[model samples]
Target: MNHSATAMAFRASARRTLTLEQQAIGELIAKLDSSFDSACQELLACRGRIIVTGMGKSGHIARKMAATLASTGSPAFYVHPGEASHGDLGMITGDDVVVALSNSGETQEITGLMPLFKRLGARLISLTGRPGSTLARYSDVHVDVGVSREACPHDLAPTSSTTAALAMGDALALALLESRGFSAEDFALSHPGGTLGKRLLLRVRDLMHGDERLPCVPAGSPLREALLEMTRQGMGFTCVVDERGALVGVYTDGDLRRTLDQRGDFSLLRVDDVMTRGGKTVAPDTLAAEAVRLMEDSRISALAVVEDGKPIGALHMHDLLRSGVI
Candidate 1:
């Protein structure tokens, strides 16, 4: 075929595949019934971990399903059905729920384990394209993930079927997540190395410069003294405190700009004359993410970490950036 015809052919094929997968997912919305609810209830009621199993392409989908369930507050893991016959069947127990994925509902490797699953008293939940197949009949809850056709021209490859099954798995994971009142903080606990965890788990105390690193000036100190402290700490600001070591105000870069604009004599002015009284502050225990919001809202770059009306630490926007809380 000509180059133009070849490009047209590729585009047509891509469109067909996307259209079929979209339809497959859309059909699942209509097909959702009490069975989906029962599956969620069974999973929620399970006292032991959720065991997901399948073979070949179905096994790949099962692994992802298990990971999603595990990350979303449900305890789950994937076990290969073929390996189960060899010895991995010991991984399952009577209290657990077994989620099996088989597009045909007749894979020998999975069907062969049905009697054992029953004998072990583990509840079976099956996702299969064939509702009347053996696996579905044996399952305690059968979710029909059947698609009318595959995206494949030969109607053989697992295209639309796998997409539908994946969508169903996501639906189950999120439904159970909501029913269990799983919060973002709970999700963050499982993902401590990711950006979301840094935002949710990090506090001002974790990122603030405290103790000897804190920059401070007495209320009546020279403006030059505060500027020196700001330069020495390299935090762009200095806390102004009373003789009792209580925070009275804050002197920042903005304050410096205004002092310069006024063309005041550096030798005669006290830090209190130009400092902002009771500037934006956060408790040491406050979430760093919340501090980010306050800084963005106030259009400031630094905050004094205060406790018991005393400046305990100082935080800068760069600190948050380094910690990945931004």
Candidate 2:
């Protein structure tokens, strides 16, 4: 009961829990069998959405499993077994696959719905500790997510078992993701509001300033005129184009700084005299994230968006920053 004894006891308990959970996850690697494969094949063949259901602690894991499966391209959603017994059973159809999670494999709320799932002709994939239980017996594929013992000192809580189930769910989701050739772009489509989605889906056209907002100066225009355009547009840069409206070069704030460093007669100079020819440029359809990389590599803050040899728009590093591309 002393402070030292109490601290040692707490550390011992924490280590024991972590060790049990680690072993539980490690054991799952050897437990994977043909049943896991069959479960994946069934889920892949399902023409309708995947419906995941469970009860109590298993229900929490089922919701997360559904989310992972859905975000990874499996198209799944969680359904509470207790709710399924109500009007929610309408969510399940003949073409769907039902993934049920039950530590004991005999959760009454779920097993009670097995006949209805069968009647609806939906395939059942069960993750259970006891393969001989009713829920497993009724399943088309039963993946055993058993653990030797709970992390709890009394072995009364669903600790290590839930960890094993979670690991199994992740393994299933990633396997199917690879099997279907799901690309990062596909994942981005489902997560369009996240950083990855913005990086993958946002294009230069979506963020570029075009038309009147695109600052441009004609070749041979006075350097003073180009400076005015850059100030007016506030893009810190201006594109230099020929008489044909084709991009000839770019002039940036950096150029203005260098021009000032020269301390020459600015009134006599033309925009072409100080412009950076063949500057960094990107297509309108190019990803904004890729544009960021180009800017970083070229050590520039702005880029000319060119199409068919003509500058159509401009993009600044500030624009990318505001859009969360940085």
Could you say which candidate leads in TM-score?
1
lDDT of 2 by residue, 249-315 (tens): 9999999999988957788899999999978899999999999999999898889999999999999
Q: Candidate 1 residues 45-144, lDDT tens each?
A: 9999999999999999999999999999999999999999999999999999999999999999999999999999999999999999999999999999
Q: At residue 46, what lDDT does model 1 achieve? A: 99
State the displacement of the C-alpha of residue 212, model 1, in Å, after optimal TM-score superposition. Answer: 0.6
Each prediction's total of clashing residue pairs, residues at least 3 apart in sequence or on different chains, is 0, 0
Error of 1 at 289 (Å): 1.1
Q: Model 1: which residue pairs collide?
A: none
> Once superposed on the true structure, which residue ranges of model 2 sit more than 4 Å away at CA?
1-15
Report the number of the highest-lDDT candidate.
1
